[model samples]
Target: MLSFAHINNSIFAKSPPFRTAAKRLFHAALSQRMKIIPISVLEDNYSYILVDDKTKEAAVIDPVEPSKILNVLSQTGAKLTSVFTTHHHWDHSGGNVELVAKKPGLAVYGADARIPEINYVCKDHEEFKLGTLTVTPLHTPCHTKGHVCYFVLDPATNERAVFTGDTLFIAGCGRFFEGDARDMYRNLFHVLMRLPEDTWVFCGHEYTRANIKFALSVDPHNEALLAKAAWCQDKTITVPSTIGQELLYNPFLRVNEQALKLAVSKSDPVEVLNTLREMKNSFR
Candidate 1:
């Protein structure tokens, strides 16, 4: 049994030397003119197209099929400069080889070496350019050891969207396939949750409806969650959930709530999370 007391031994327990907020995202990054186009594929998978309308340059995140991505590129009239792989999962990386084959010298950035055609290995806080916009790769390794979330920022408009592969979803998170509760705790709270409050959450799957169902069962009385659940029923896709919005309703993000702790009969945050994960696994 993994205990919450040993949290520091997990992958993200050690704090990196991150720059101060003012220096990290300079004041100029407020006027970015980028558009996030969500491509629906493989039943519930999502591939995001980040396009710089000004430069006509773009990057694809979590591409699973080439034809689908290609159609978007053709429609947007944007040239593909790179592919950002969030993890080693087939659903997120299946189109890497084909995209690389179609567009030569197209960089594939990922923390996982297992990601197919990964030519650009991303390091923590590694920044790259997609048609003049800045993309920072945040290493959040709970879903899979090398899972990363791409933070796309427009320096001019200061607009942002995080391409969260399977690490963090809309109202839920990825299953603990490679790591444990402690690792997930840091990934969700210590790392990703610390991003700017208004950051757009562009996750890898369309699992909001199901996630909300489970979320309601656990955090049943949240008004924001209840409203969001009602809204989800009428939509085919639920994404671009803001960080501020997630903080209000996501059960995974609210493990510290007194209600959640009591419902799971756990005192420690990690233990509560583990209990939540176990319960949610069989929720249906």
Candidate 2:
């Protein structure tokens, strides 16, 4: 006497207790995955704590103070494995000495000697494993001669993100202090842009609002930029801008777009980048 609908419902439905226990287990499993926590230090700087929850191993990127990082480690119950430095700027490397002093034999990685307490000088294109996560260091030296970006990927899944330390921002790129516009073009377009469009961008600053303002000035007609401006107004959503969204709205990445080219009055991408950078340097 069982109808088809009743049979289907019987097969699919679960008892309340069973569903509750399943939900709890699902949440517990999700919580055990690798996580990236952004710790804002100084005025606009962001130091990240990349933690692999299953193994409870952690790496602090560009720490400004040891106490903040120690606090995170204590909260997560994760042991400090190493520190990743994107560039040698003082704000980015300030806590390196103290962190190493706290965790003796901790491997601090960077591209140059300027990063304090750098025990492991990472080379470009090198891959390092941190628990279930795999990190590839991309040497993007235009920010500084030895600047590098750490690209983190979950080998078992399509989950990937890049830690762009001062080299690239949310809607803008870094100031070309040590290199020319050409270096930036190569690093931003040729190097970083080649990654999957969904790669999460975790830059080193809370400059998204200013950067978006600059972007809207040059690329006003872009719907993505317009929507993003509306969303970003009076709010701080700094980390985790995707490559796809940036390619759509970021003027630095959209140098070849006709609207941005006209705004900058330049045709060549590098020239457009130079013009945009100069404009941003003086942009309110």
Number of the top candidate by lDDT? 1
Against the correct fold, how does model 1 do in TM-score? Answer: 0.88
* Deviation in Å, model 1, residue 75 alpha carbon: 1.2
Candidate 2 residue pairs in clash (backbone atoms < 3 Å)? none
Q: Counting only residues 3 or more apart in sequence or on different chains, how many pairs clash (N, Cα, C under 3 Å) in candidate 1?
A: 11
Report how far off residue 170 is in candidate 2 (Å). Answer: 0.6
Per-candidate TM equals 0.88, 0.88
**Per-residue C-alpha lDDT of model 2 across residues 25-112, encoded as one tens digit per residue:** 1132243355666676788888888877667788888988888778756765778898999999999998998888888998899998
Each prediction's Cα lDDT score? 0.80, 0.79
> Which stretches of candidate 1 lie above 4 Å from their native place?
1-32
Q: Among these predicted structures, which one has the highest TM-score?
A: 2
